[model samples]
Target: MCDYTQREYSCGHFRWIASKWCREYTLTHKRCQPNVTHFEYRADEPCGECKPKEYPPWENLIRRNKQATY
Candidate 1:
């Protein structure tokens, strides 16, 4: 397997979007903030990231993972 220079993560919330979001997703990369490891997606396999076909982003959700620490 190949490991990119980046990573991926998410958060767990009880009342809000997880108060720990501050602890997680707080890494800095490429001068940006997506402090998580995002797997390299093949041109034909973009679905691998959100596998199990459930975490699809609807018109109401955004990919603010800026470092998902889940």
Candidate 2:
């Protein structure tokens, strides 16, 4: 059954940095501090932020992926 829900995302900036051992990601930020990782990035990088957005459908997307993989 299709539930009456929607998917949305907060207007936030995100960045993924790759390392030899693991990958790092950012969801939000508090200041203008530059996020660093093992991979090289410019020093003029800005942190991410979040704004009002939908949520329910996005959760379902994650769940669906997990179920399919498992």
Candidate 3:
């Protein structure tokens, strides 16, 4: 089973998403700062409280970096 995490965005949004340590720590990939506010082990239910941001703030940083390299 995949690990699920409760993360908070810089915009104060929160979401329960799959935990991907490689994506978070790998330097070659775009970093997604889903500040893991909590970890839900054996999460059988979805979060119904916190609303997630429509767009992650870190996406912008990735776009900028790609443009600079081009």
Candidate 4:
């Protein structure tokens, strides 16, 4: 399983990022900083702080793609 977590920004943006690796350094040092793989305005529940904006066609595509994965 992948080690990761979801974080919510003050701007009402949600992002999925790496958490930690299980194994120690072996052959090569490949430590990676927490990286954001996805980002989007919360659609299920709107936040008043950021007052969500409508998704454009491209962003809608991203939203749909993200939905498909999970």
**How far off is residue 10 in model 1, in Å?**
25
Which is superior by lDDT, 2 or 3?
3
The candidate that wins on lDDT is 4
Give per-residue CA lDDT, model 1, range 1-70, as digits (tens).
Answer: 2122332223221111222233323553222232333443234333334445664568357647678697
Residue-level error in angstroms, candidate 2, position 37: 11
Any runs in candidate 2 off by more than 4 Å, and if so which?
Answer: 1-38, 50-70
Residue-wise lDDT of candidate 2 within 1-70, one digit each (tens)? 1112222223334445322222222323222323343333334444444433557756866634435553
RMSD of each: 16.5, 17.7, 13.4, 11.8
Candidate 3's C-alpha runs over 4 A off are 20-70
Candidate 2 similarity to native, TM-score: 0.16
Total backbone collisions for each predicted model: 13, 0, 0, 0
TM-score between candidate 1 and the true structure: 0.16
lDDT of 3 by residue, 1-70 (tens): 2345775544455567756555445655564555554554433433444434466767767534435553
* lDDT by candidate, in order shown: 0.34, 0.35, 0.52, 0.54
Model 3 TM-score (2 dp): 0.23
What is the lDDT for 19 in model 1? 20
TM-score of each: 0.16, 0.16, 0.23, 0.28
Model 1: ten consecutive residues of lowest lDDT? 11-20
- The lDDT of model 2 is 0.35
lDDT of 3: 0.52
For residue 68, model 3's alpha carbon misses the true position, in angstroms, by 35
